[model samples]
Each structure stands twice: as structure tokens, then as C-alpha cells.
Target chain A: MDLVERIRSGNKRTLSKLITEVEYDTETGREALRELYKYTGNAHVVGITGSPGVGKSTLVARIVKELRKREISVGVVAVDPSSPFTGGAILGDRIRMQELACDPEVFIRSVSSSAGTVGRTTKNIIRVLDAAGKDVIVIETIGAGQVDLDVLNVADTKVIVLMPESGDEIQMIKAGLLEIGDVYVINKADLENAARTKSQLSLAIKERDGWIPEIVMTIATSGEGVEKLVDAIFAHKKHLEDSSNLRKGRLEAVKSEVVEILVEKLKMRFYEKFSNARYSDIFEQVLDKELDPFTAAELIEKEEGL
Target chain B: MKKGKNIRVLIAKPGLDGHDRGAKVLARACRDAGMEVIYTGIRQSPEQIVETALQEDVDVIGLSILSGAHMSIIPRILELLNESGIGDIPVIVGGIIPPDDVEELKRRGVKAIFGPGSSVNEIVEFIKSIT
Candidate 1:
């Protein structure tokens, strides 16, 4: 059978291969996705993101363990940042979730965020998991500060994991995480000042648009309060479904995906047009101080009939 | 396409060995050499190794076995990789393999073996050359 057929039949190997294809943006991967796109939209996509060392990976591993107890088939997309100098990543998230590695019902894949847009690759991988019949798909983003709101566009439920010692509540608010988090978590709650941080987060989360985001405190290492966090996630899922918010979220996701694809296509077209001898000639002219970038761009536009 | 895309390698330790200093060092070396390294932690089963390798879609699988179980574990991994239809992907073994076991491992589809004090640069270069 072909890749699409194998993926639809719940083949983990094919699902993985297709995910790699999409992650690398290969032609075969694109064709596979085009064929399998129609099989998507069934799984609930959840994005778990937070600052580094807040125990995001540990929390996700605990959540996946709890999810399995409820007989949920999960697909985890763990994203790790690539080294800027080396283009290499440690991808240590799977180590935390190693218990789930041998579980047939649980599929975990680690991806490097260096593959262009983390959000786009994440969404595409979620689609592959959905096509493979996972009931819940979790996207764990690179915990690199506050620039990771891209997860907001790819998940049905956006969860931001934070710690009690994550610093001043005002800083969290300023980071704009308060606005995007559908469910907030105070992980490492065993640390001192847990209650104080919870209260501060509670005050910061005031009711928004009729949906109040719940703050759940968790000691991920011991799996403390993970059950309540799971409950909050289910409650949020129910709220989205009951209030028809799911439809709105799906529409936004589709819109963002379209924009991402369009931007990538335009970039590819621009590179294809300029990656020849003409590009080198322009570079040499710029290096010799014979042409400014702006003038060179205008000349190229005119010459290319743009 | 970019000149050289990221080379993904899965550094897995199978069996009950907890000695990961060598594995960690190799992972860092590969990362420094500009390859994505996915460390599977310690004491992983062959099933877990093969499954993780397939899911990660790694270009190379580096097995770190400090115990004297390379004879048993290496073949299991190779068999599983072949069964999974991904045997073409190179499998490199590291850690205490007897010199007598080297030819046998290579014959059983083990690509390369890096023993004690083996150069990390050599491992990186081998991966680059093979993949």
C-alpha cells in the first residue's frame, strides 16, 4: 500500500516517515500530506509551551501518562530549539517521556525548530497524527522565553506552563502569555511561594470573554495535581465544543496555515528566481560598492518584469 | 534546498547500563559538528530504540552499550530495524566491545564501533561520511 493508505490504516512507521517528510518539507512529504489532509481534523490538538526549565517536558510526560490511563491514544510533537551556531538540537524531551516510548498507543516525535516555522511544521505533524487516528495530539514547543506564541495558532487548547519562581507576575503579564493561555499551570508547585504565585496568577487571569482560564498547580516530578490539570484541559475542551469556540479556533488555524503556506511558496519562488548567476552578479556588484541593495532590488524587479 | 540540512542522529543506550558519560559526550560532539542529536536517555530496550529511531526518522543510530551485552543487543536492534524495513539506515555501536567482537558486529550489519577513548571527531566524521 501507499503511504497514505498505510497512514490511514494506523501504521506507526508510515506515520513517522510522513512526519519526517513534512518536517523537512520534502516533495514526497507534501504529496503525502495532500493525499492525507482529508483524514485530519479529528484529533484534539493541544499546545503545551512555557519558559525553559519550568518543567514543560516533565509536565507533558505526566500529562501523557494520565491521558493513557483514560485510554487516550496520544501523539506528542516535542519541539527543541536548534543551536544557532551548529544547527543541531539535543531533543531531550523524549528522555522525560521515555516511559511512554514503548507504549503502542502513544506516539512521540521530536522535531527541531530550525526547520523554518515551528508553527507550520508542528501543525503539519499534528495532521499526520490525526490521520493516524490519535485521539489527542500534544505539541510541546521550544521553551525559549515569550516568543513562542506561534503555538496559539496550532492548538485547540493553548496551555502555558510556568513555575512558582517564574518571577514577578507583572513580567508574566507583560510577556503577553496571560492573553493567549487558555489554561495556565504553575508547575514545580512544591517549591516555596507556590500559593503566592497561584494567587498572583489568579488575580492576573480575570474572566475574559466569558471563558475563565483555570490555573492548576502541578509538581510534575511527582505527578502532583496532574489529574486536576487534565480535568481543566477536558473542561476547556468541553467549553470550546459547547460554546462553538472549536469552530472559531479551527477557522483561525486554517487561516494561519494558509498564510504560512503562501509565505513559504512566495519565498521559494523568490529564491528560485534569484538563485542563479544573476544573484551572484548582484552580490559582486554590492560587494564592489557598485550598487546599493535597494537599487539592485529595483533593477531586478524591472528586469524580471515584476 | 539549503546546502547541508540538519543531520539527525539518535544516540540510544540499550539494556540496563546507567553509564552515560560517554553517550553524553558523543551527543555533544555530534551537536557541535552541526547534527541534530536525540538522546534516548539510559537503559532503553531494543524495541524502544527501534521505535524511537523510526519516529525520529534519524539518519544514524548510535548505540552506547557499556555492559558486555553488545553481542546480544546489537543484533536485536539490527533485526528489528530490518523487520521494520529501515535496516538501510546505519547503526553504529559504542562502548566496551571486545576486539574479537568487532568483525562479528560489522558482519551483522553494525556500521562502526567506537570503543574507549575513541575520538569524538572520528565518530562525527564517520556519520558525515556515511549519511
Candidate 2:
């Protein structure tokens, strides 16, 4: 409760703890979110993503630092998904942004997509944090050079980062990177083929339709050319809002999320009850093809009414 | 003797290295041991791993780090759990741990380190002993 209150009052420690608890979906976490939900919607959510080696972490840290310089309070959410058999997180991108955790005006949260759903639960809890009162939110998805397009679905503004010459237009097309970028950043600007990479991305962008996403060139590690990237983020966020289509999309998404949460809860409860109950005889009867999945579902729903 | 309740385990793989064959296999083994095992799909963060272990009310946070970044990642997760008051969760380490770092993780409060070639029965037995 103290953490919830303090987070609402913009306390970094409280916000950090609350983010962890809520991301974990603890009872207190849910309650804290419920209390703070009304305070969300104030923070702008900016999602930073791209292929694995595009230096998304370094890029995100730079962006957060830049935003902080503007006196804007920011919350960072980073997702890491490297294998741990070696006994460590492979990406460790969150560590790049770890310094911001100590800042009172900045709250940073790292989520492993492994522990969370395609970020739906993470987003819910984070939206709760934002409502509790942060000025901006940035989410870094796990992995590099994604083909899944999962992060684009999660972000208010999608910044797809690419390392110049990391790959060609064909590679970007193969990874489906061409479609997800609301803003394309050719990072590693200090590299040898920065210009060539930009041209290839330009070709990729031209080949795509609709919004004609902007492409920015950056050298994220040294903080070179990141301000333009942040400006592009804000602009894109504004563009999405001004379009008014975003509101409708958001409403639909919220409704879908609520439906999904309830369905999952009921499904889990049904599974638990079915697994533990003395309905084995009935199940066996059905197993003989006497009852179908629909009837079974109906019976379970009728019996539980949850 | 078996502990007060089932030994809960959270099996997680964090970061971009998405080879999950080992993680899935280990998850199944832990469950077969009669431990309540929660498998966080693939590519998790130290924070997500720590948070899930807390909420799942798990007894052991078994991390399977295949990527080479284990040195930097495992310590941060331990720190987060400690910060959250559940530092006593009796963390376990698994997957390609270099033999040299095995003792180091244990010293950092990791109770056990199970790597490639480790047996499920042995892991179960180890968990039983700890619990």
C-alpha cells in the first residue's frame, strides 16, 4: 500500500517494487494496480525494438537519458530473452539502462517475455504504473531482428532499430522488419556502411505502404544522433493520436484484453476443477466419443458457472 | 522427509538466445519430481524471472542460462529477489554452467547448479534434500 501510494506520488522505489509485484500478478500487485489504474493514461508509451544485434538496449538507454534531459520523467520496460544455461542473461540490455533506476524521476522495469505473455499482462501492469503517474513509458522487447511482429502490436509507437549493414533489404523483408517500424532507425551510424544501410532501409520503406514510417540514423552506444530518434518517437506518438484511428484501436484492444483475462481465469479454474473433481467417469464416457468438446465445455461451464 | 508443501520451481530462460530444448526438458523433469513447476516460455528477463518466482510462490528459482552472459545476469536476479525480501528462495542454476563458475553461483546463495549431463533423478534428489 505504501508503495502503491508513493508510486502514485511518483516515488521511484515504490514504483519499482510495485512494477515487480504487478508484473508477477500478486494479489497486492493487482490491488495496487486497481488503485493506480485511474492515474494511468498520462504517460506516453514508446516501444523500442528491432533485430537482436541492433543494440536496442544501448539505444533505449540513450533515449531515456535524452528524455530525462528534457526534464521529462520516464519509465523504462526492457524484455530480455537469452538462454540461461550458461548461468546468465545473454542480452543484459537492462543493465545498460540500470543507471536510471537510481534516479528519482525515472523508474525502470525489466520483464522477460518468457515469464510474461506477448506482454499483454506486462502492458496491463505497466499501463497501471503509467496511470499511477509517470510522464512517459518505454518498452524494449526481447531478442533481435524479430519476425514475430509481437512488439509492434504492443507499442504505442514502434521504433524498429537496425544496425547498418547488419543485413540487407532481403534480410529485412525475410524478418518482416519492413512492416513493423513506425520509425526505422539505422543504428551504429559510426559504422562503415551507415549510408549503405540507410539506402537499403529507404528501399524497404518505399516498398511498404500506408504510413510511410520515418527512418532515422543513429550511433546509439556513443549517444550520437539519438535526439532525432527521440524526436521521431514523440512525433510518431503524436501522429498515432492525431489520426484518431488509434483511439478506436486502443478501445478494441482494451476490450479484447479484458475478455482475454476473464477467459484465461475461467479456463484455469475449469482446468483445476476438472483435474481434481470426481468427474472421471463422465470424462471416460466422453472419451469414448459419447460427448464432444463443446458439450464437455458446456457441462463444465454449467456446473461451475464461474 | 518431504517439506511442508510441494517444492515449487520456476524454470526460466532469459535473453535473445532462444534455444529452449534444454529449458523445456528441465521443466518437465522438475514437474515429474512432483514439484510445482512454472515454465516461463522463452526469452525472459532477470526481473521477470524473479517476479514470477515470487508470485508463483515458488521455492526454487531454477535458471537455465545457455547464453554466455550468465555472469552478469544471475547476480542481478539474486539482487532483485533480495531487494524484494525473498532472497531465501534457494535459487538453483542449470544449463551449460562452466565448472569454474559453479562454486561462484553457490557462494552467491545459489543452492545448486545442474548443468548438461545432470540427471533428473539427481536434481529431484537434490531438491528433496534441500526442501
Candidate 3:
């Protein structure tokens, strides 16, 4: 059988293979997704994002365990940063989630954000998991860059995880994280100043028009206060379902996906049409101050009929 | 084989082994060689390794087992890879392996064996050649 059939039949290997194809952005992968798109739109996409060393992975493991207790199948896409110099990544999230390795109901995959546009490859991987019949699909991004916030577009429920002593209140606000979070989690709450951090976060977060973002304190190591966080997630899910918010979120996600694909295709077409020699000539003119970049770009667009 | 494409490699430590210094070093070596490396941490099961390899669509599977469980672990991974129809993906073994078991592992479809003192350059070159 083809990859789509194998994935629909619950073949974890084929599911993984198809995800790899999508991650690499191959034609075969695109064709496979085209065939498997019909099986999607069933899984609840959750985005768990936080800064480095904030125990996002540990929290994810706890959430997966709690989700498994409910007999809900889960698929995790742990995104790790790739070295700009080497294009390599050490995907260590699986270390914290090793307990789920043997659990057939849980499928965990690690992806490198260096593959392409940030969160673009991850969104595609989530689609594969969704097509594979997962009840809940969680995407854990490398919460290091501003680009990581792009995950908000793909996840229906955006869970922004923070530690008590993260000490980046101003940085979080600047990163636009305060605007994207649907649920705020103060993880590693057992640390010092946990309450202070929680209060500060609450003060920083402005109330939404309809949904007030719930802040849950969690000690992921010992699984303390995790159930409440899960409850908050379920509550958000229920809220989305109760309102037309779920449909609206889906429409927004589709729009983002379409725009991303279009931009990528346009970039490829632009590069293909303009050779390096032409680019070098343009750069030379810019370097010699013969033509400004804006004028050069306009000239190229007019000449190429782009 | 596009220009400047990364050759993704999954450097995994399967079985009940906790010695990961060698795995981490090798993972870095592969990374420094300009290949995308996914290190699976330590004490991973064969099922997890195979699943990760399939998911990563890695060009190679590097097993770092110092627990002397290579006899039991490597074969299980090979079997799983074949069962999953990804047997064509080469499997390379590293770490402390007795001289007697090296030939046996090779016969069992291990692409290459790197014992103690093996240079990282050699391993990276071998992977590049095969891939």
C-alpha cells in the first residue's frame, strides 16, 4: 500500500517516513500530504513554547502522560535549533520523554528548525500526525528566537510556558509572546519567587475580549499542579468548541499556510530567474553607489515583469 | 543532492547504556562536518531508535553502545529496520566492541565498526562516501 494507506492503517513507521518527507520539503512529501490531507482536521493542535532550559520538554512529557491516562493518543513534534554554521542539531527533548518511547499510543519525533522557514516544517509535520489519527498533536518549538512565535499560527491552543525566575519580563513583552499566548503556564513553580513571577505575568497579560488566559503553576519534575494545567487546556478546548472560535482559528491557520507556501514558491521562482551573475551586477552597482537598492529592486521587477 | 543540502544523521545510543560521552562527541563531529545530526540521548530502546530514524529520514543510523549489549541491541534494530522496509538505510556501530564480535556485527549487516581510538574524521568520511 501507499504511504497514505499505511499511515491511515496506523503504521507508525510509514507515518514517520511521511513526516520526514515533509520536513525535507520533497515533491514526494507534497504528494503524500495531498493524499493525506483528507484524513486531517481531526487532531487538536497544541503549541507548547517557552525559552531555553525552561523545562518545556519535561512539561510536555507530563502532559502526554496525563493525556494517555485519558486514553487519548498523542503525537509530539519537538523542534530543536540547528547550528547556523553546521546545519546540525542535537535534538535532546526525547531524553526527557523517554518514558513514552515504549508506549505505542504515543509517537514522538524531533525536527530541526534549520530545515527551512521557522515553524513551516513543523506545521507540515503536525499535519502528518493529524492525518495519522492522533487525538492531540503537540508542537514544542525551540523557544529561542522571535521567529518561534510563528507557532501561534499553527496551534489552536497556544500554551506559553515560563519559569518563575526567567527574569525576562520585558523581553517577553518585546518578543510579542504576551499577545500570542492562549494559556500561560508558570512552569518550574517550585523555584524561588514562583508566586511573584505568576503575579507579574498576570499583571503583564491584558485580558482578551472573550477569553481570559489562564495561568497555571507547574513543577514538571514531580508532576505537581500538572493536572490543573491539563484542565485549563481542556477548558480552552471546550471554550473554542463552544464558540465559533474553533472555525475561525482553522481559517486563520489555513491562510497562514497558504501565504507561507506562496512566499516560498515566489522566492524559489525569483532566485531561479535571476542568476548569481545578475545579482552580482546589481550588488556592484549598489556598492559603487550608482543605484540605490530600492531603485535596483524596482528596475529588476519591471525588467523581469515580476 | 541539491547544493548545500544537509545529510541528516541520527546518532543513537540504544539499550540500557548510559555512557553517552562518546555519542555526544561523535554527534558534534558529524555536526562539525556540516551534516545535520540528531542525537537521541541515552538508553533508548530499539523501537525508539528505528522510529526516530524513520521519522528523521536520516541518511545513516549510528549506534553507540558501550554496554556490551551490541549483540542483542544491534540485531534487533536491524530487524526492525527491515520490518519497517527501511533496511537500505546504513547502520554504523561505535563504542567498545570486542575484536571477536566485530566480524559478527559486520556479518549481521553493520555497515562499519569504530572501536576505541577511531578518529571522528574517519567516521564522517565513511558516512559521506556511503551517502
| Cα-based lDDT for every prediction | 0.87, 0.70, 0.85
Candidate 1 or 2, higher lDDT?
A: 1
lDDT of 2 at A178: 72
TM-score of each: 0.91, 0.64, 0.91
Per residue, candidate 3 scores C-alpha lDDT tens digits across B51-128 of 777766788999999998889889999999999789999999999999889999899999999999999899999999
RMSD to the native, candidate 3?
Answer: 2.7
In model 1 chain A, where is the ten-residue run with the lowest total lDDT? A144-153
Q: Model 1, range B1-131, lDDT digits (tens) per residue?
A: 43366888999899998999999999999988889999889999999999898888889999999889888888999999999888989999999999999999999989999998899899999999999
Model 1 spans with C-alpha error above 4 angstroms: A145-147, A267-306, B1-3
lDDT of 2 by residue, A191-219 (tens): 89889888877776742224568888888
**Tens-digit per-residue lDDT, A38-143, candidate 1:** 9999898888988888998999999999999999999999988887777888998999988888898999999877745667777788889999999999989887
Task: Encode model 3's per-residue lDDT on A1-306: one tens digit a residue.
Answer: 877778988887678777767777788988988888888899998999988889899999999999999999999988888777777677778778878876888988887777446567777888888988899998898987755777556888999999987875675556478777889999888889999888888878876648899999999999998899888998889989998899987897788779967987888878876765667788789899999999989988887887
User: What's chain A's TM-score in each predicted model?
Assistant: 0.88, 0.82, 0.93
Q: What's the C-alpha lDDT at position A146 in model 2?
A: 41
